[model samples]
Target: MTGSSHFPVRGIIEGFYGLFYTAPERNDLISFIADHGFNLYIYGPKNDRQHRARWREPYPDFIMKQFAETVAHSMNRGIEFCYSIGSGVSINYASEEDFRLITSKYQAFYDIGVRHFMIMLDDIAAEFHHEEEQLMFNSYAGAHVYTANRLFHWLKSLDKSCKLSLCPTDYHGRAPFSDYIHELGKGLDQEIDIFYTGPEICSETISEQDTADFAAAVQRKPVIWDNYPVNDLAMKSEMHIGPITGRESSLPRVCKGFIVNTMSQAEASKIALLTFAEYFKNPDCYEPWPSWEKALKTIAGEESYESIKLFAENSLYSCLGYPEAALLDLLANKALFSLRSGEAASVSKDVQKLFDYLDSLDEAGYHLKYRMSNYALRNNLVPWIEIMESLAWAGRRAIAVLRALENNEDITAPLNWLKESVSEIRRHPKRYTGSILLPLIEYVESKVD
Candidate 1:
């Protein structure tokens, strides 16, 4: 039986809004989200006076005004705005200053048009073992509470209302899911309408059972910082990049809500999410989108998700400062296909271009030169090589289709390419570290051994 009813899917939204405030990127990003089907957009600009400095002071009026206009555009497009306020973002605020900063951040957002806001406390705190770090953690957690509680009080203090979503400061790197959940729940302002991640955000593995449990435990109307829409449940690399939707694990849940977090990696592939939504709304739409040409004018817009994603990958590595993330992170996410990879022929011609492109790029061992997104494909060569090796795997699949056209399946041509890739890895073992490379290495060693 299909597990379609495990979770009731909602219309879809976001908990974080990536920023490129120094230029026109932010404007482009917001418009992109609206075209796709996200109704909520959280504003988390990297650095600005409203967040980095004391709230008692004025934020540069021009930036502030422009930001408000951006929010207005979001609302006009039917998107809800969630504004983030705090100094920990820049890692430089003390308690009183954090209070001053977050308070103003929230107020500024609310004044503009935000009905939702997020308070990030656990993150600013440092290593708990260090006295100074512990002090920072405490101060940071307090400021979160100060902002959160005050937010509740402020709502009571005024007729204006909002839905407060708070994140535990130590969230990104924490374990003992229970402790994290408990601490977050204990400190949760009674007025808080939702918790950001709860216990379901996966960094290493995407387990349906775990998501089910997190939903059960967090009785509040749960809202998640859905990372599957990006890539995780493995190291922060791109081993098995697929599409942007988390269809396999998420479509069957009956819960509060979900807010996907888009980044430079997945935002460009917004169609993935829209495709996922169509399936969630009606699985037959599970069929691959016709084309970005169709999807962009219809769902994703302009370029196909494949081209947009490639552009993002090249943009990151070739242009953006954070050349550390990868495109595969966005591609290999299996949850995208309702957790199923359909027949290649079934996928749109534009969507299929990615595989064709990878198949053709020059290869050295398993590492092929991807020049699309600049330095954004920052995953270790291990994953890159694996995909390169998977060229062997991807090629095997391709052979069945190609062999009929041409006799003598000279898989050796690509196989030789694979051998060269393995040899390159052996030649530069130091370049490939960690446990990820082992499988690809062993796959090749077995050939020689």
Candidate 2:
């Protein structure tokens, strides 16, 4: 199978911690996913109390109605709607009452046309909390296996084709497999899919060998819960705007399928998600740069594509790595080195071009800040934009300082302006990933000092 058939399940999972999307946003996302060759949309926002903290309670009528409408909309677009409940937060594996509650909760979603269900045991305690549960089951994984098997059997009874995905408590780690995972793998029904986040929760890369090893250990092909383009958890400070790389082409063959966990900023996430769609469709032939360029053009549209691309280059630094900003950093280094080596005449044209690029980035920052229609993108990207704008200002000042040195003029004011620009860039709250400007700024500051 290739294209849509190759990856039986390729889509986005609304599995972030903070700020769940509004109903309209989710509906738009469903349409977006369907158009981009994605087939699944898992509704598993961590903050939804009824889905997690209050697992036994029914959603209020308004929320339930929204879910029904969303399900209908997803169906209209040829997408599978997977309703995920985080019942493991407080679920009692040994209690018949808890089992009934779980069934009833899923029944409600099944009534709303959700044929796919996910029970998320991630981020919950690994041990059996209740004394009764400890007595009933030998281990925590044993308890989860019991609940998941019961739920899977019930869902199968309702519809034999219904799919179930389980997110285990021990989802990510290297070596020394936890007893919980071993028991869950040994005990889980073959029909139930298991979710794994590779070797780490927010892994930088997921190799095919790692996935294959995990499959061997787990006795089933794990469904990759890819945490790329997701900016929650420890990555809350950075926005991941780069293309999806580091995943081997053979990943789809080893794992069940890949589902990207998107950022809170839906519009911005499309830049990476579209590339992910291309990768899922044909990882063997996928090229990150071309896919990323296409994604940028698609997200920003022709009118604003160039401008957004300039801004996106600076924001492309993520946990994955910073390939997009590599050329810019190289140019900055060359410009600075040329000035320092008294090769000003030879590097003049290159310096001019670099300055022009910086000016364009400043203008792009202005456009993204004031004129962009996507409020989520604008709001979520404010920190990076601030940094980019400052970098542009600093770059321009560096050029001015170089020109002044070439002309044998006093460079005090321009140097001060450069320092101030660097300071402004440093003032932003989030600066871990996208700091391409840091090296250039530090080099220039060293010269000034």
Candidate 3:
């Protein structure tokens, strides 16, 4: 790693901004981040306009005050807060009230010591806007920018200096981000910051050209909002982050800071924050990262990639269809997650024992340990199990079906799983325990033979 190209981060903000509404136990999550070395936490509110549910209502006065408590707690620990409002009112159509509402609320955040503001444009829409402009407006954070920049200018208008960050609709997080770097950084330089995630690795060796292209596109250093993979929250399968342990070593050397997005799954926020910290603080960060050896030690209790995968896969399975969705959201950070549940891994060889145990379950026709019983397993738990120590690809599909049943959610996925499970048992008699897995056996047995 070249010292010169790598703009050393003086302080780090291993962020886990909430994309959804606040979680019930947010108080615990905030305390965890401060204990770690995170400098910022982006509180981006979700749909709260309805003024409803437990935590779903708009940032209630009490909630915002509590949010302030977390920020103050972070400040005492040296962390900063970034208030990111919605991206809905970006175009010319939004009323002045929307502007007043956002700014006034934002001022509340400012009163709490937030130094940075991120305007997300892609989320807001203008019916009259063209796709290109729509994309561009999204990139610029639409009318929110009008409010934010107006806020920026207002603060500056009042001679107050503040930081401005924008998440465009596209570009910054795309494969072609570099192709439009200059444009992506337009009008938002000096004080403006770019926060983004992408479908491809912009910092990989093989994707050097793309990385370089992306680096050139932002015109200024961008902040990394590294996203963890997620399907549906209800599925047990959407549990783990992929094994990109080495990814931290490859981020664009030019990035100003990175916030490993922990989304709504705030409970495990500390785990994600710690992973990024270890990688960034240590120079040979990736080469040994938690050392594949030690990471493995925790993964399978015996230092091997296979053991680690099982720990992740099965744990994911256990978490499958867990309700409180807030839990599912945080568990998405599969990358740094350790899998084994009760044992302390003292050596690498122990992992084989763990897998062997799982294998024994499979042999005994005990598929619950696999995906058969969980949504995270994608239907046939075998596919997830076989690859637990090998792949996380099946996770791409949402936990559409099983999760619904798990959560007692009314979504179509779970209902269909039940209907299908019954017909499936009849069509394929060899699948489950004759006593338990049989289709509606109670209903079938209650009638005359």
Candidate 4:
């Protein structure tokens, strides 16, 4: 909790595009973040029409009640609940009526004790859509800064405690950014924080120098809107249960805050968020694997650790960059190397180790399917777990076929089973142990002729 060491804002934003979390889920996450020493939570899911598409409108009474409860619960847990609105999708920045509508929307939340807000102009066209906006402002950034600055002043007038953040259209890339962003940096209120998503929207690596360069361009320290472990849109097939990686420990020096964009599965997202909690706690000494193992133990619990670890290792590939199924890759490579060397003793030992790992992968899926106490996590992982089992089965069958050939035995049964397992794996789009599994199967198939 010391100011000198940790990020000013360390939290998760339930800001994915499709199928936002339910009220209960958000409440649970708020409590979870508080326990992990995180200090902020932003609500800005794109699918919530009232929060995005219908930004000018107030939330219905029932939904407003849920938001009130969520805000109250967050405050109770010592977490700041930042209500975010995606207004750029259809905002008429020049219209006084539109400005009033946007402020009125925040006024409702303010009444419910919300003092933190974000005006999101992301994922929208940079060009002005309205005639009035085009005539009033020279560029996209000009219109956005005009609205944001006005909002900041009005919010300050209502309450000096009000905190506002603005997400610029050109929110990512190496600096100096687009003219829009440079203009945003110069024109936007300095008191208001700007959101920047590293070198790319879904950046693989966020270096210290890159962040410093961006801060220089923005004319203020930017709050990192880190997009990781968020499997939505085109990435619907992924299950990102891996650790946080590629972010420099020196990031806190250049950035104002750090916030993760989470996946649709609330419980599963906690696995990655827990690692994020560790990183933000003491970024200087954070090690991805150790932090990841600790996160698995803390969130998944001891009973399901091995199973969840195996599952997580296979599901690690995302935009954040990780070697998928690292353990399996190691063992498979060792076995393949031994096989190539024609060392019978080494081959027997290494190949058996690989086979054992594959066996465990299959067993882990089966055990988690029926035995995992966390039903929500289990449900979220079902698709990937099934694929894990399929890949394991395929690996085992491939090994069996290879062994049978070595012994001069008929490969019919094992070969047929291998084909069946591969077929099962390919039927679904879910990925686990992705690149390694297919090449191993192809290598075994190469042995057949």
Candidate 5:
């Protein structure tokens, strides 16, 4: 399906490595995407054996029926359901039988009412496997170009309105285009869209200049395969629950829309996906924080918004970088500054306020664990909540120890509690990413010692 004015060609690609979404979850997500104005959904979970590992095989009857139903569901909602195949793992690029096998797979999906198609050659060995393929093609680029071009023509012959896209092996970088990309850019059909993930697979920012440079190298505007909020690979322990950042506003002018690589957790993914919709709809005027807060309120429900926000703020660290928790850090330092400057009496109220805030965060953690509607989010955040609660307990004990010392009362027990709480936080089983409390814990430890 082609992009229209009301809806950009933007969509979500279920392209994460672990834990494929269930059929129900996929259906729910499609509905969510339609409600939020996203126009496409690419079904390409990396772990789906048929989609990647066994790319040339047709789906079983049950699976095919589900996919057909999904395509119909998306069509009813004005969303294009793109079927993606990653056949590069074991395809004999030079063989006509291999081409026919791949074509047959696409034709099956085409019969299922899917007109949008993608061929993903990402994350495969760069070398050809068969001697015949090596002899027939000069390089890996030639193989991919030949396969993609052949498929493009075959699909066009069947239906001219069919949209085709490709994800090259060398899909990211700044300079010195790989022979694969260079050859594909020169030889591949220009009508087929190309997918790029900026300078790196999980890039910090996608700038207009960088995209323009990539477009120049590829001989076509790239459809950004944005990997924001996808915590697969080494980032599996983390959940990216923050607003999308670092992407410049003018990106749409240079690239052909984006397809967000969403997390496996469907419900939590909507938080970031909502913001992506906002950014794609009006890149020039998008404000992440406002969109983020609205998304939380809408997704988490008003009653549970504050608790979800409390958990989400701590989970904002992604491959791009940590979100600025400058205000909290500054307040924490200020409280310590008061103690060091011998102005404890003057800033006692501010210290109390900071302590209260931290305490409330601990309470919010409890609420998130027991009360939030999203079980996956709660499960993912349990470790972080434990850390936050331990830190809060430690912070309060440190304050108590300080107050005891100032008043010249017995301080041994509170000091020991502070030490134990700090130990609890440091020894927690799960390592939370981008912890804002670490610095505060360090400061408290210094003061207690």
Candidate 6:
């Protein structure tokens, strides 16, 4: 089966740096992607020791069994399971022993009916680490091209149908591409696919021109490793639950395919993946917000859709740059503007509207925290949920402080509560609603002193 999309290849890559998914979670995700029209699943989580740090070592028996099971399930679902190896950290490119180890690792997977493979050289130093490699090759790209070519030929020898791809060290940025990228592109086997992220590691936008420029440099169309919802490294505190944005509809015509890098939170990552599915199926007609809404409704179900929607709205700030807490921000801005005018009627209407929105935020938090039936999603979202609740409560108290002082009543109680809630919210490192609530708190503080 070719899977479901206008784009020939569209799927997920378990390529994040943190804790990888469990076997059941991965299998479930394979099913999820298969159902959503994704045709490929690349297994290459950085934290998978055998796949990365200890690239020369074999997977443990239990782990190998899991791989076999996953490959079988993915095949049954019509999704290609592409096993990947990240050996750039310490592979001796000139060493025949190292080459043997690479083939030996892949041979095991090939034995189990796996046919697609990728040699990921991303996120590693470009300089030759081994003396033998330094002596044999003048540049980083030269060494990489030699090793990757050997592996591609080996995989083809084992089975002519086997496919190979590479994720180079200089995977992002615009042309004038680095000499390393240009040389690697020109020298590598014509059939071996190369992976490219857009202009940045986590690109905000990927235009058709961007891919066209990259393909011109690489001498072949690239397989995009689009990194959006993956919240690893610097973005660990973020919950990237927004829709896929910044990718032009015309991308399918220019590039070979797409492989989305997902977040460690498998359940939460589905929200964005669902939208990605919509894009892949009909890029020309895709609308991020509508697709996102549909995904929320499908994943959260009817009973909890509104609550999940409210919660999701606050956490939409990822690399895609969607507004954080958009509705709450609008209401708060209106309320603050009305307060500045010193109009009692305006303040009463606007501030109350802001307060009501905050109340809804709090209510959404409570519903997801206590009653949402999807336990895995709830668990994945607990950190952001708690932060949202705290921010909502704190915002409410800030408004209360303003009201009590406005009424010429004692402000000590509300003021103290406001301080405590803000403190509690700040204690957690995760972000919710961005800085939209800060001005209200600042305004309240300025008046009291």
Give the per-residue lDDT digits (tens) of candidate 3, residues 5-103. Answer: 443332222222224534434445456555655556665543343111112124668867777776777677655666665544443324455456556
Better of 1 and 2 by TM-score: 2
**lDDT by residue (tens digit), candidate 6, 1-449:** 12234578787899999999999999999999888888899999999899999999999988889889989999999989999999888888899998999899999999887999999999998777678787999888888888999899899888999999999999999979899889998999999999989999999999999899999899999989999899999999999999999999889777888999999999999999999988887888889999999999888888999999999988888899878778888998988888877844225798898889889989998999899998899999999999898888888898888878777889899899999989988798898888898898888888889
Candidate 1, residues 258-344, lDDT tens digits: the string is 555543343333544554445444433455334322443343233223433332232222111233234433332221232124333
* Model 3 spans with C-alpha error above 4 angstroms: 1-24, 45-58, 89-95, 123-148, 157-161, 171-184, 199-211, 229-236, 241-243, 246-252, 269-272, 287-310, 313-356, 359-449
lDDT of 1 at 245: 32
Q: lDDT tens digits, residues 1-449, model 5? A: 22234235788999999998999889989999998778899989999998889887788999999998999999999889999998888888988998898889999999989998999899988997889988898888888888899899999999998988999999998866776677889998999999889989999998999889889888988889999989887877676778888899878677888899998778889899989888877777789999999998888778789877766765666767755444556667777767666755224876787788778878888887888887766665676678767867877777777777767878789888988987886777544433555555566566556
TM-score of every model?
0.55, 0.90, 0.56, 0.94, 0.89, 0.97
Winner on TM-score between 3 and 5 is: 5
Model 1 TM-score on a 0 to 1 scale:
0.55
Best-performing candidate as measured by lDDT: 6
lDDT for position 224 in model 4? 93
- Top-TM-score candidate index: 6
Q: Which residues of candidate 5, in runs, are more than 4 Å off?
A: 1-7, 322-324, 342-347, 373-386, 398-424, 427-436, 439-449
Question: lDDT of each model, Cα atoms only?
Answer: 0.44, 0.83, 0.42, 0.87, 0.82, 0.89
lDDT of 4 at 196: 84
lDDT of 6: 0.89
Q: What is the lDDT of residue 333 in candidate 5?
A: 73
Clashes of 5: 0
Model 6 misses residue 81 by how many Å? Answer: 0.8
Score candidate 3 by TM-score against the native: 0.56
Q: Candidate 4 residues 1-449, lDDT tens each?
A: 45336688787888898999989999998999898878999999999998999888788999999999999999999999999999889888889998898899999999999999999999998787789887888888888888999999999999999999988888899966787777888998899998888888889999888888888887999989999988889888888888889999889889987889999999998988888887887887788889889888777778999999888877888887777778889988888777767744225898899899989988999978999888888888898888888888998898899888888889999999999998998897887777786666787888897
Of 2 and 4, which scores higher on TM-score? 4
| Residues 1-449, model 2: lDDT tens digits | 45665677797999999888999989999999999899899999898899888888999999999999999999999999999999888887889999898889889989989999999999986877788997898778778888899889899999997888899998987655787787888899988898888888888889888888778767999989999999987777777888998899888778878889999888888889999988888888999988998988888777667777887776666668656476677776666666556667325666776788889888998988888776667786777788778878987887777667768889999998987887876776675225655665666566556
Q: Is candidate 3 or candidate 6 better by TM-score?
A: 6
